[model samples]
Target: EMALASDIGVMVTTDPSQAYAEPLHAWLFGEDQGRYLIAVPEGGVDPILRAAAGTGVPVRRIGTTGGAVITVNGQGAVSVAELKALHENWLPVYMA
Candidate 1:
């Protein structure tokens, strides 16, 4: 729900294959520790890269943000409005 919380769209261009030499079973359903996705403002990523490099922390640009639809590899995953509705309606439904 990053898009919903940040009020921006996100497109995931990279997949598990990029980071893993072999296929990861259930990668979509599994959590890898210390992995993170961050949004950097346009034209502001160089510093972050430099810092990461200096600290020996691997980082890469994986996505871009804007628009209203969340997409992965150019395929629309979901819209912010739909997710927001789900988030807002979940509690009431659960309570009932």
Candidate 2:
């Protein structure tokens, strides 16, 4: 939810399930080494992509940023307010 805290939302257009050739769950939750999600500003991603390509690093444009809700491929969207409430209340609720 860092993007939400940064006053922006993420629209993940690419299906994360297609990230690997098999066992989608493994790719989704497994701690695959050296993989990273980098956020680049508009019009600035080209340089990053080019640099990664030069170094033989795999880079893909998965999403963009905006709005008040974080959604993936127009599916489930959880509002920032909901996420903040859950984060802020987790400790208190658990203590109770």
Candidate 3:
């Protein structure tokens, strides 16, 4: 849990960011956890393209840091309860 574990910025997603990784993170951590950068799909790379271009690394701008909240595509804010439901539904493979 970055909220209690670290005192630095953490990269939140990877281009070709796999499956539920991005969604679960944005919902669980949000800005309240720390300053974070989420990688988006191909169309969302302009913000970090120049900065990361020469490094041979790809980056993108997906979510923005605002308040203590979880937002997906600037529309859905995954509530704590919703996050719990998500885990209950999706992560059952791990629980058993």
Could you tell me every candidate's TM-score relative to the true structure?
A: 0.74, 0.78, 0.33
Which segments of model 2 are wrong by more than 4 Å?
A: 15-31
Best by lDDT: 1
Clashes of each: 0, 0, 0
Give the higher-lDDT candidate: 1 or 2: 1
With a 3 Å backbone cut-off (N, CA, C), the pairs that clash in candidate 1 are none
Number of clashing pairs, model 1? 0
Write the residue-wise lDDT of candidate 2 on 1-96 in tens digits.
566478677787766555466564455345668877778789999999899899998888878888888877788897867787788899999999
Which lDDT tens digits does candidate 1 get at residues 35-70? 776777888789988999999999887778998878
Q: How high is the CA lDDT of each candidate model?
A: 0.77, 0.76, 0.47
What stretches of model 3 exceed 4 Å from their correct place?
1-48, 79-96
**Pick by TM-score: which candidate is best?**
2
Lowest-sum lDDT 10-residue window in model 3: 3-12
Worst lDDT window (10 residues) for model 2? Answer: 21-30
lDDT of 1: 0.77
For candidate 3, give the lDDT of residue 70.
54
